[model samples]
Target chain A: MKEVTVGIDIGGTNTKFGIVDDAGTVLYQSKLPTQKHADFKDYIQELDSAIKHGLEQTSSDLQITGIGVGAPNANFYRGTIEHAPNLVWKGIIPIVDIMQKDFNVPVIITNDANAAAMGEMIYGNAKSMKDFIVITLGTGLGSGIVANGELIYGFDGFAAELGHVTVNPNGRNCGCGKVGCLETYVSATGIKRTVYKLLADHIEESELRGISFHDLSTKMITESAERGDSVAKAAFEYTGKILGSKLADSVAHTNPEAIFIFGGLSLAGDLIFAPTRKHLEANLMPIYKNKVKVLPSGLQNQSAPILGASSLVVDHLNKKSSVNI
Target chain B: MKEVTVGIDIGGTNTKFGIVDDAGTVLYQSKLPTQKHADFKDYIQELDSAIKHGLEQTSSDLQITGIGVGAPNANFYRGTIEHAPNLVWKGIIPIVDIMQKDFNVPVIITNDANAAAMGEMIYGNAKSMKDFIVITLGTGLGSGIVANGELIYGFDGFAAELGHVTVNPNGRNCGCGKVGCLETYVSATGIKRTVYKLLADHIEESELRGISFHDLSTKMITESAERGDSVAKAAFEYTGKILGSKLADSVAHTNPEAIFIFGGLSLAGDLIFAPTRKHLEANLMPIYKNKVKVLPSGLQNQSAPILGASSLVVDHLNKKSSVNI
Candidate 1:
């Protein structure tokens, strides 16, 4: 009869949900195609079915807490998904109102990057970290900044757009109509471009000899590097160094304890970690030269997002319960 | 009579203390030579004498709430001055213990920058702001970051070291043994150095005619800019532009409501503000562009430190106060 919270992590193409307990244990989990429908209500219908199935799996006596959702362009204060770039939903989606009606409990929503950071704080390797930047190197680079144990939401609840920050003023063109963003050099798209640029400059022979950017993937490159492929290894080493140098400069701004890396491209392991540590140390000020540590997130793949989303519910309920009692 | 808190602000050469009420009204304020003492304990004795004099000025009915101190390298967690580079203190000074024993009340201590940020948040122009950065651009840049209404103290209480963040990578030498730190080109010494560099590069410069780095002061240049001196005006414009670009990058990291400027150099007004605003808006991302406000502190120059120090006591007492009692 353990109480449960339904946590939903919304992606552009897929939506994942899970029932989590007080001790951060996931009792049940499932995923569904998110982009199958044209309108936002169809996605809600699919989400409703998933919640019902999750409730059926638990005992009747098991109490339900609240629902927490993590999505792109989610606003915690307004409780809406405003201008979610990838989703077909044209306007603000009143997610909190709809969720509250179905669950009969509190509903909390926040941007995906923020949710990931909270998840790391609550159930991952960054449990005791107060100031740290969580970087997700996926299709596009996403960052969550935790300062003073709370997420930074700017005046319009749009802070921590680290991907859009110019890393090299004239280096790369980003999808966000910016030049040389951190993501433009660190994301999956970013690395492939770097590989192409490197290929054009170097006469070195490798298995990536004639691979086009369309056929390339981060997983393939990581596997190739694990097999001692030079080009794949170079791709990670160069990417990690660039990211580490910028991160070193960023570290001095807030002097965080450590940096946590997750998502697809970060899984390159030694190829990424070694150069990142080297360049970070090389660029660090004496006060923070060897002090800040960089490490991989410990949250198990799919579980991380859901747990982070669940933490929103836990945080919301905790605030409400504390206020009333 | 109402309760009053004693506020102390310690600088390299001078130490100032004042008795302040809840409204941030300074009843009595005085200063002492800070560098005269050999051992740090001697400084404590001198501060104690000043507090005693102030307490005697008022009746016993005027209850002394607590003492709050703002100094370099002060840590709120440990309540110790850990390696204040400006002071000759050999090791960590136990500041809170001495103050508490004298007044028989609670005492709190934090760094000067954090004190300023809190001062602005509670009583100054930035009172309503939850996210803001306070820059004390004087001998060096001292920044205090407030996000979500709490000052950012990282895992080890060394967060918000914005001065040391590298800007040029190979530009100028800093006291911290780093090159191209933001402090190198934006502080008092920083501005002077930029003027000197510009003088060296220019083939036709007349007004800044024979000024050496040591001979030129930030005030002298600011005065020149006010009177239509091109070189002096150029220095300020360049300084503000660089600062604004850096600020834009900072905004991307943690979008704040506004960035507040204070301390000696910031008094230049429009000379610094205009260029900073122009460049900041130009460099900002679309979501944050033209939205974030930049301003100066509203606390009176003399009372800001005192009230800010007192704020530490208020915040501490509020957090630790009992629920039922």
Candidate 2:
């Protein structure tokens, strides 16, 4: 029988699950509204049923190898999601434990960004690269560090919290109770906040000045930027400036070959990339200047998350098989 | 025959060479004035003679296994020293190749901090730890990062330039042409600058205000602090604050089990440790709060550099023998 692995990407609003082949092809796919089920057990039941349906839709001769999950605050070592603020369910969620009891297959879980890094290494631009970093700009900034051809889990299994690293000592208050976190100034939400701050600072003629913070979206700002709104342009420039400077600092740690930017903000293309690249080089140490590349995700946006989550299972299977050999 | 490795620590002023055993013992030691030789070939010849003399001091039954040399800007991959500003040699020096040709044994070269890290792993407190950081606060702040029991060399051989990481963008100008590098505020030279700045900022009478920047030393500051000098104490506190805060950022990259401080500045004991530890805990992320350790090097001040440099040979021998088996 052909081998297939189950990949799941859990988000605040919805959870995407798919049956994927060894070649990273999604044979079957499904989604569930995460907030619909208040109880953890009910959510597990719905998730299991959806997985079973996906398996049924796929080829009957396919043998299930393992399952891999990517979640907001997931811990690979403990297989638990701990106090993730955006999630519907509160407190530690033993996801791998629940999934394993239901599916009776090998299960692994990690923070979504780490899964993205694994995806980049196994199936994306970093296939041949040993040292690299993957930064995801979504609701908040997330990072995954790969060094010496291995993912750095660190001592706590929660390394690569680049989003929380302070950029300005007194910059902004974060939900993690830190001041000047990179996420506070670099994420999609961060850009919108920047737009309002720019609007207040400069008396520039801009269409975005009237929009409320809740009403403002990254799409609206991107559209405004496309139309050459000064505030929107400044916001992107400011975001990139902060991000690029911090990226230079991260370089001092691992000295990655390239930094791959994935997720929503990355879709802005050169608007974000231009300023980030300029500032990254401007801030780098003389020896590292022009040595590193800032690139976009090679995988399609719709498939990148799923692909990253699936690569986890593929990585596990490869390691397991190698051990047996 | 007894197996031994030659470990050499090459500095701008003096070069320390020693014969060491697998147990991290320095059997025989000698020093050579580095800057006295104007030409690279002259320096090499002098270094070769020093190594030969040290080897002669040992018994004839001793078997030469390998040689490890630690320098200011050594690269393991190229086995060359790059543009190290402090070194007498201006450009790349093929020290490893020259040493190999002379010694006819397995030779390895790495930056002093990397050797210090290897020393910590092989002979010091990190013997059992897989992930830790070694920060040497000597003339400048040098760092060696160990993750998963291996040094992270990145894409280039030049990773772990922690001193160059920006601590305060507007703070101080560094020799690397960067402003606000951590080394600008925390190294032996850094603390001296801090002492001068504090003397200017505060009206509190201190004896150190009379000392010139050229004559000021970390030892004098430590003694002054021991004698209840408020300015010296403030300098230590200020240095710790900047270092601890930046270290908090580094922790986000690799959640190290412990951070070992070695070199001249670390000799201040509680004067440096008390503030660094307090500020480290204060600035840590909530999850990492009080989980990581701030420790002093277990190796003696005189022996640590030599042992760390010697560990290169031990590491090389270990790897070579393992490959054969």
Candidate 3:
């Protein structure tokens, strides 16, 4: 019988789940609204039912092996999600424990960025690379560090909070109650804020000037920049500069071979990668110059999240067997 | 016969070598002037003779198992010392290969800071720590990062160059050709520079005003601070603030359980520790705050360099055996 693992990605609004084989192929996949159920237990029950439904639709000869999950604020060590602001659940939720009780197979979980890093290592561009970093540029900037051929969970599970590292000591206030965080200048929301700042700083005529702060979106900014809007272009340049310079600092810490950019803003392509690479090279120390590469995530855009979450199980099983050997 | 490893620490002025057992004890130790010979081969020959002489003084039953050398710009993977500014050797010196040819035992090499970190993990305060950082505050700020209970060698052997990380974008001019590196603000030389800047900025400084930049030393600054001199005291505070804040960024990257301050500047004790700990706690993100301990190295002062170099052999053998198992 073919062995399969269930991969679940719990986002703020939607939770994506899929049945995946060891080769990272998605057999069956679906999504459920995360906020529809206020209670975490109810959400778990619905998720279980959905997964069961997905498994039934797949070939009957397939046997379940394990479950791997990716979520914001997920703790790999504790198997809990703690105080994730975007999630409806207010406090710590024992998602792994809940899943483990319902499923006979092993249940493992980590933050979305770490899951993405594991995916990269297992089935993406980093398959041959032993040391690298994955930066998820979604609503908030998230990072997962891989060193010595393993993910660095640190002393606590929350090691790679690259977003919260200060860019400016007193620049912008972050949700984490820190001022001048890297995310304040580099994430999807950060670029929007930068666009607004650019509009106020100069009298440049652009498409972004008409849109209100809440109504403005990263997609609109990307579209405007592609059409030669100075404000939108400046926003990407500014964002990339901050990201690139900070990544140079990250390089001094880990000295990774390459840094992969994942999630929403990465889709802007050269608009973001160009300035980031430029400034990163400019800011690096002489010994590190021209050595590190900044690249995009190799995972397919739509199925990337599922693939990342599912790869965790395969990685864990491989590690387990290797340790046994 | 009892098995022992030889540890060699090559410094700009002196080269220290010692015979050490697996129990972290120094069996026999001695030092020789490093820059006496113009050629690296001559230096190596002299070093080999010195080790042989020291070993002759030790118990005759001791059998050589391995040799570990710690020096500036040492590379673990290549086992070469590359472009060490302080060393007489102008280019890459294959010390490990040379030593391996002379001694029919394994020869390993890494930078002094990494050696110190291994020493910490094997016999110092970080014996039980799986994740921690060792900051060597001597001529320049050097760091060794330990994550997942292993030293981070990075893609290249030169991973933890934390001293070169930018503390200020356009601050001080560093010898490394970088502006405002962490070493410029936090190392022994950095504090001296800070003292000069403080003396220039404030007219209230009395004692340090008489001292020339070349005459000034970290020891003198510590003495003045101990004697309640405001300029010296303020220098400590300013240095601590920078070190602490930058360490907050370090914590964000690796999330170490503790950060151990080693080398010369660490000798100041509370003068450096108090302000650094306070600032480290203040600048850390909420989750990491109060979690990481800013502590002093557990290795004894005079013997630390030798111990650190020696620990590398034990660590390498242990890892090799574990992998074999």
Candidate 4:
């Protein structure tokens, strides 16, 4: 039986959908604008349309087994998208009910970080790993913790929010209204904030002098680093130092086998990797030093979110038979 | 079939053990001097004698299904006690293999903290909880993390060393050679240290000054607090404040349903509880405050270590079928 699953990776800007098979292949895919709807009903309608069109491209009769969704603030237990900052919707939206009604299949949803972790476990380099941490340092620091080959969704399906954990009590003001959060100092926006601070305080000549907040991006920082811009390079080093030390602290708690880095800031390669490794080792306990490996996510480019979402459905359905009752 | 298990809890000064049934009934129990043997093998023999006598006392010939051992620096995967600080054993001893040879029953081993956590899950307050952190604040701080209904044993089976984690980088020197560990501020020894510091600096009049470090203990501190000794009460207040804040950080990471504290320091009652609860709630995120319960261990008064250790063996043997290939 060719079990096809509808995988939706919902972002603030766009929602990407893919019709994936049981063999871990994406047979067809499409993208839709996310912010086009006021109530998000139009968004789901578009997603239904995308899945319908994608299914048509498959040669055999494609029986969509279920639906899996990955989005910011998606609550697994409630099957709803909770107060997600990026989304236009203000309150809870029952995404599962909507998706199931449209597709007539079992629907599930989880936070983006956990979905990415599942994707890595099922379809990426983390296949052989039983305990690994999937860290997505995009606009925010999102972490999906895998221990004993299962996602650690705590009592309320809210666990592994590494970004909100304090790195410094009085360091930086986080969007979460906390000070010195891991996310405040390590993510893409965090790097930009650091760069701006450096630009304002230090006397360095660089191409990013006049760039506004909207104009600047992690890509620009990477390009500047490649061109020997000391300020841009310093930003990465500072950010990575905080990240590395935080990783050491994290190791003390979970002792994960490896940490997988994915998302925007991670694309900086050595700019982020070198300093992170150095600081992580310096801060780690003697027993744990250099024991945990840092690796890049196996999914290429933008395929991660989609694959991660789909992986949830695939893994969950597989494990459903375990309950004897 | 009626099955029983032997649970052994090894401490620096003494060892306690019991024969425990499936319903958590302690059929027979005893305590013996841990210093009975200079040789590791001798200690094992003594433990064997204890277990044999305990089983014989029970009427029905219940099959001894398993043996559980808990000690400092114990390793679950290796089933060995390695270079534990207090144990006179000079090197790694495969205690599980030694025990298995005696009865041909399954044997399991874990550190003391993990055993306590297992005891909580199987026989104590956290029986209904799958996500919780059990912190033992005795001579030192020890944490056992339970996530997704299982103990999180890391790659080296040495995960959940929350005490050694840096809560403050420059605060205090820990026995682990680290600075500002949570244990250095919250454990029984840590509380006395806080009392001395308060005495030396605060210029407060108190009965605590009459006592020497040789006789001073957390028990004395609680007594002084009950007698209205300003410095002694302040020490516990200070200890609770630090512990609670550290726990708040723990909440941010694991988001556990509850944090159960056991051991001497927790015996101070509201002298420790009030400040801890206040500070924990003050520091916790809005979603976690009031939602996350910080409570004392239900097994606080009982000789839980041996029970916990015994529970480990039972839990391990119970899970054997899960890993059956």
Candidate 5:
């Protein structure tokens, strides 16, 4: 029988789940509004039904293997999601255990970025790479580190937090109660802040000056840069300088074969990537220069998250014996 | 029969070799001046003779297992030392292949910092720890990263060069043709530079003002600090602050359980540790607050390096079958 695994992505607004084959094909998929159920029980009940429905859509010839979940603040070792700010659920939720009780299968849970890394290793560009890093640039920067073919889940099972690494000591005040975080300068929201700073710094006026802070989006900045707005172009340069320099520092720690850029900000193409790549090369130590590849994520937006989440189950199964569930 | 492993530490001035048991006990030890042998062949010949002499002291019951060598710019995969600035050996010297020809055993090689980390794991405070970092504050700041109980040897076999990581972008010029490396502000040489900068900054009457830049030593600064010298004390504080803050950045990448301060500067005890521990806690993100420990290396001066090098052999042996040699 053809083996199929369920990949679940639990986002704050929407939860996307799918039944995927070993070849990374999404056989059946469904979604549920996560915020509608503030109560943990209600959320789990709906999630259980959604997953069951996804399984039912698959043919009888297909054998269900296990379930893999990607959520904010998810812990692979404990299989729990602890105080994830984005999610409605507060405190520590034993998500894997709860899912396992209903599904009776091996339920592996890791943070979203980590799932993306596993997906890259199993089904994306990092299939042959043993050491590589995946950076997700969204509202906040998230990272997943893979070394020696294993996701680095340090002692606490939350090892890779590249965003929180202090890039500037006295630079910007971060929401994490820290100053000058890499995420504060390079992420989607970070670029907006940069645009405002650039607008104030340079006396030359641009189209971005008309837009309010809340109204501004990364897409708007990209459009502005394409239109030859000096302020918007300068913002990308500043952001790339910080990100590329920080990535050079990370290269010293893990020595990744490649650093894959993912998420919305990455979609900006060469506008963001060109500067980042230039600064990364400029800041790198002599030996590391020209060796580490900085590339875009191989997985596409619509299916990448599900693809990554699904690979988590396949990755686990390949390592251990099959669970009865 | 009791099995023993040979641990060799190759330094610029001298080479220290020792026979150690699995229990981390040093049975026999000796040293040779490294720079005397300009030719690589002569150095290996002397090394082989030294090992033979050390083996003669052992009884018939003592069976030699394998040899592990720790040196600058050593590659674990290639078992070669490549372009080590400190050493007289210039190009790639396949030390492991040469030693294996003589000793006929599994001769393993790695950089000294990595050896120190393995030593800490097998014999020091990190025996219980699966994830931790060891920062060696010598002439240059060196680091060994252990995550998931394995040393992070990235794609290039040279991953953990924490010293070269830029702490300040425009801070200080580094020997590696980079600006503001952590080593420039944290090591023995780094502390001396800090003292000089402080002397220039502060006009207060101080004994350090009398000492010329060339006449100064880390030991003298330690003595000056002991005598309640404000300038010397300030240097340690400044160095600790930079080291601690940069260490916080490293923690974001790996989330190590503890960061052990090793080597010469670490000998300053609470003077260095006190400020480093303080700033580390202060700079740590909220979620990581108080979770990571900053401790001193448990192994004292001589035994630590040897113990670490010996552990490399044992570490390799534990994973593989017996070496034919």
Candidate 6:
């Protein structure tokens, strides 16, 4: 029988799942609106049927080895998802325990960023690297730190909250009840905020002048910057400066061989990477200069979340049997 | 036969060596001025003879097992001391290679902070902890990070340089050619700088008014604070605030169970600890608040350096033999 794993990615709007083979290939996939059910139990019940229907559509010889989940505010040690603000669920949810009971297989869970790091190690650019960091630059910045070939769960399993690290002390208010968090200035939303501030501060903008704050998006800013828009360009520059300087502080913490930029803002390519690399080099300690690389994620964009979640199963099975993949 | 190891602590002024048994006992100890010989070879020759003489004074049944050295800028991967400003050695000195050849036993070398971390794991308060941080507060600040029960040597074997992390982008100039490094405002010299700034900023009847910069010392400042000197007290409060806030950033990085303060400044007790703890809690993310303990080093002050260096040998031997001691 061919062995496969069920990979699940839980998001605020939709929940995506797939049957993945050992080679990181998604055999069958489906999605459901996350908030369609008011109760978490009802959501899980619908998810179970959806997954079973997906399995039936796939080739018949496949046997699911385990289930792996990626979600927000996931506690790996407790196998639960704690009060994640973006989620409709109000309290702690024992996702792994409930999934294991239904699937009758080992269930594992971690935050999406950590799962992404594992995917990078198993199938992306960090294959040969034991020490590296992956930064997810979506609506908010998230990070996964891999040192000595293992993810750092810390004492309470909530480690690597890089976005929440204080940047300006009193600069900007964050949703996490903190001020001047790195995410407030570096994520996609952060880039938009910077553009709005630039437009308000300068009158010489060729584009992005009349764009409403709610209507503005990072793609529009990226396109405008590509067309020589001064405000848009300055926004990316300012965002990179903050990210690069803070990355220097992180380099001091773990001294990773490379830092991979993943997710939405990363798609801006040289606009984000160039400034970040330039500032990272400029801000680094003399010994760390010209050594660490800042690179883009190697995983295919469309399948990244599913691939990341699936790789966790392979990693878990290998560890249990003392085998290296 | 009683197996013992030689532990060496190479300081700027002196080099201390001790013959230590398995149970962390010092059988014999001695010291020599580090700058007594100009050439690195001559210094090694003198150290070799000194160690032999000290070994002869110990019990006849003791068998030499290994050697461990702790010094500033020591590299574990390269087994060399690289461009240490405090040491007489100018460039990279292959101390481990030279010593291993001389003694015909396995030799290990790492920075003093990392050695202290190993000592804490083996014989100090972190014995039960797999994840913790040790910050040494002496003439300069140094740090050692432990995660997943292993020291983070990083990709270049120079991880955990927490002292050089920028506190302010435009603040005080650091000896490392950076501005506003944490150590520039938190070490013994850092405290002295703060006290001088306070003296210049305020016009109070103070005992520190007539003292020149060269005549000032952290010990004197501690005494003045105890005697209710406002300048001295403010200095401590300022130092603690910076240290505490930066520590919150570190907690976000590794999520350690505890942070141990070591060396000269830590000897001040509540003068430093109270402010540091207060600010650390005030600045920590809501999830990490009150979860991390900021405690003093559990190792005895006098023997800490020696014991720290000695523990490296025991740790190395255990790793080689696949034993957990």
Best by TM-score: 3
Which has the better DockQ: candidate 2, or candidate 3?
3
lDDT of 1 by residue, B245-316 (tens): 888888987788899998888899999999999988877878787788899888758878888898877767
Model 4: CA > 4 A from native: A204-207, A321-325, B320-325
Q: Could you tell me which 10 consecutive residues in candidate 3 chain B have the lowest summed lDDT?
A: B197-206
Displacement of residue A199 (Cα, Å) in model 3 is 1.0
The order of the candidates by lDDT, greatest first, is 3, 6, 5, 2, 4, 1
Interface RMSD values for all candidates = 1.5, 0.7, 0.7, 1.3, 0.8, 0.6
lDDT of 3 by residue, A203-259 (tens): 989988789999998899999999999999999999999999999899999999999
Clashing pairs in 2: none
For residues A11-39, write the lDDT of model 2, one tens digit per residue. Answer: 99989988888777888888999879888
Clashes of 2: 0
Error of 5 at B200 (Å): 0.8
A79-198: candidate 6 lDDT, tens digit per residue: 999999888888999988998999899898999999898889987999999999999999999999999888888988988999988889988888888899999999988998899888
DockQ of each: 0.67, 0.81, 0.86, 0.66, 0.83, 0.81
* TM-score (chain B only), all candidates: 0.95, 0.96, 0.98, 0.96, 0.97, 0.97
| Model 3 docking grade | high
Model 3 misplaced stretches (Cα beyond 4 Å)? none
Alpha carbon deviation, residue A105, candidate 3 (Å): 1.5
- Give lDDT: candidate 3, residue B313: 87
- The TM-score between candidate 3 and the true structure equals 0.98
Q: Can you write out model 4's per-residue Cα lDDT over B207-277, one digit (the tens) per residue?
A: 98999987998888999999999998889889988888778777776779999999998888899989999
Candidate 1 clashes between residue pairs 3 or more apart in a chain or in different chains: none
Candidate 6 CAPRI level: high
Worst 10 residues of 2 chain A by lDDT: A316-325
The residue-by-residue lDDT of candidate 5 on A154-268, one tens digit each, is 8888788999998778889998899988899989999999999988877898999899999999999999999999999989988888899899999999999999999998988
TM agreement with the true structure for every prediction: 0.96, 0.96, 0.98, 0.95, 0.97, 0.97
Per-chain TM-score of chain A in candidate 3 equals: 0.97
Q: Answer with 1 or 6, whichever has the higher lDDT.
A: 6
**Weakest lDDT window of 10 consecutive positions for candidate 4 chain A:** A316-325
